[model samples]
Every structure is written in C-alpha cells, then in structure tokens.
Target: MSSKPLLLLTPALAVIGLLFGGGLALALLQSVGYLAALGQTTLTLDAYRQLLSDPVFGRSLLLTLWIAVASTAVSTLLALMAALTLRRSFRARPVATFIFQSNLPIPHLVGAIGILLLFSQSGFLARLSHLLGLIQQPADFPALVFDPYGLGIMLEYIWKS
Candidate 1:
C-alpha cells in the first residue's frame, strides 16, 4: 500500500519474474526443437505432431482428463457434504471438525505419499488385515494404489482437498 514497500519488493519480484519467465521461455523453445547446446536451432512442431498422432498418447490424454474431472467432482461433492454437516449444531462437533481440519496444512505430495503408504499392498492396512486373518497375504489386499481406475489418486486428491 506504500511506495516505500513497493520499491523494496520490486527487486525480488523482478528477479522471480525473470527467472520463472526465462525458464518457461527456454522450455518452450526446447519443446519446439531449439536446443542451442545440442546444436539444434530449428523450431518445429514435429514432437507435438508425433505426440498427437500416437494412439497411446490419445488414450493417456483421455484417461488423464477423465481422472481429473472425476476427482474434482468427487472432491467438490464431499466438500459440500462436509460443509453442510459441519454447519449444524451437534455434539462432537469440535472433535469432528478438528479431525477434518487436521490434514488441511499437509502438502499434496506428502498426502499422496501418505495415502500410498497406507493403502498399498504391503501397507499397514494390508498387514493388519493379514494379521486379523481377513487376508491371506499382502498381495491379497486390493490394488488401490496402482489400480486401473486411478482410484488411489482420486482418494489422495479428495482427502487432501
């Protein structure tokens, strides 16, 4: 709000903008096949063309979009449900709210890793299940992490959200 503060922040902001902008520019140039170190200066869209033409790439793109949309929808619905539930006057509200908010500050990568560790085949749940005679071995646990539907990723996103 003050000129003095703006002046003081100008240098750091400029440095950050320059570094980030320059790196993005370099990446774009390299993506277009303009790597100077490798002696390739010609810009072309051959890489992108190849990528677009690949059948596997198309499938991967579709799967990624589906996963993103599904996770976002599920997370939004869960958040809405939680908000509605928490807004009411009820007993154990403090405990429930605390438990819900406890993971709010965790980073996405950390939460994802935590989910992986807790849900993987050899994870604690699997071991507990085995110990309880519910599962025969770690492999008997369901494939939640590396499953075909990206359920683990959605779980991480929803939980972190």
Candidate 2:
C-alpha cells in the first residue's frame, strides 16, 4: 500500500519471479527436446510418443494415481485428526496445534528429499533392512522409489503439504 513496503518486497518478488519463470521456460523447452548443449534441439513429439509406447510409462501413470490417492487420504486423515485433537480444551492445546501444523513452514524440496532419503530403494530404510537381513540386496528391497504404488512420493506429499 505504501512506497516503503513496495520497496521492501521488490527484491524478493524479483528473485521469486526469475527462479520460477526461468525454470518454467526451461522446462517447456526441455519437454520438446530443446536442450542445445545435448544436441537435442529438434523440438518434436518423439519423446511423448516414446513414453506412450513404453510399459514403464504406463506403470508410472498407475503410480501417479497411487500417489495421488494415498497422499490425499493421508493428509485428510491427519488434518481431521488434528482438528479433533485440538477441539477440546487442554493445557497444551496451543502447543499441540502449532505442532500439528509444523510442517507448513517446511520447503517442499526439503521435505521431498527427506522422504526420498528415508524411504527410497537405496535409502535409510533399505540400508536398515539390509543390516537386519530383511533383504538380501538392493533389488530385494521393495520398489518404493519409482514403484507402481509410489510409496516414496506418497510419503513426500503427505509430509510436505
């Protein structure tokens, strides 16, 4: 509303615009195979056609469905439970409420990486499983990284936002 506040917000807004807008432009270019350094500047739909014909891409579609459903269920359940828990009066209700929403301040990238490190095929859980003899090799572990069920991605979504 004022010149002072406008001046204060200008730099932050500029940085955010540059980062988000530039990344989006780059992604749009790459989606059509326009990476000049890689000599892939053909800008064709061949990549999309390849994905359509690949079984793994089909499986990825299924995995995306799984991630969406699981993340929605988990976040909704957590929100409902938190609301119920905070409904009643208690000495520590304020603290509990803040704790319930603590994840809101976390960056999405950090939360996603945290989930990956904790749950991916070669992640903490995998190493723990190996140490405990629960799995014989890395391949023996469940496909939580790029799984049909998207276990890692679901956890990331639920934890991040």
Q: lDDT tens digits, residues 57-150, model 1?
A: 9888888998899999998999899999999999989998999999989999999899989999999889999999999998999999998788
Would you list the clashing residue pairs of candidate 2?
A: none
lDDT of 2 by residue, 57-148 (tens): 88878877877887999989987887898999999998997886788888888888887787777888888999999999755777777765
What are the per-model numbers of colliding residue pairs?
0, 0
- Candidate 1 has a TM-score of 0.78
Question: TM-scores across all candidates?
Answer: 0.78, 0.54
Model 2 bad stretches (over 4 Å): 1-51, 120-148
RMSD, one per candidate, in order: 3.4, 6.7
Residue 142 in model 2: shift from native, Å? Answer: 6.4
Residue-level lDDT for 89 in candidate 2? 99
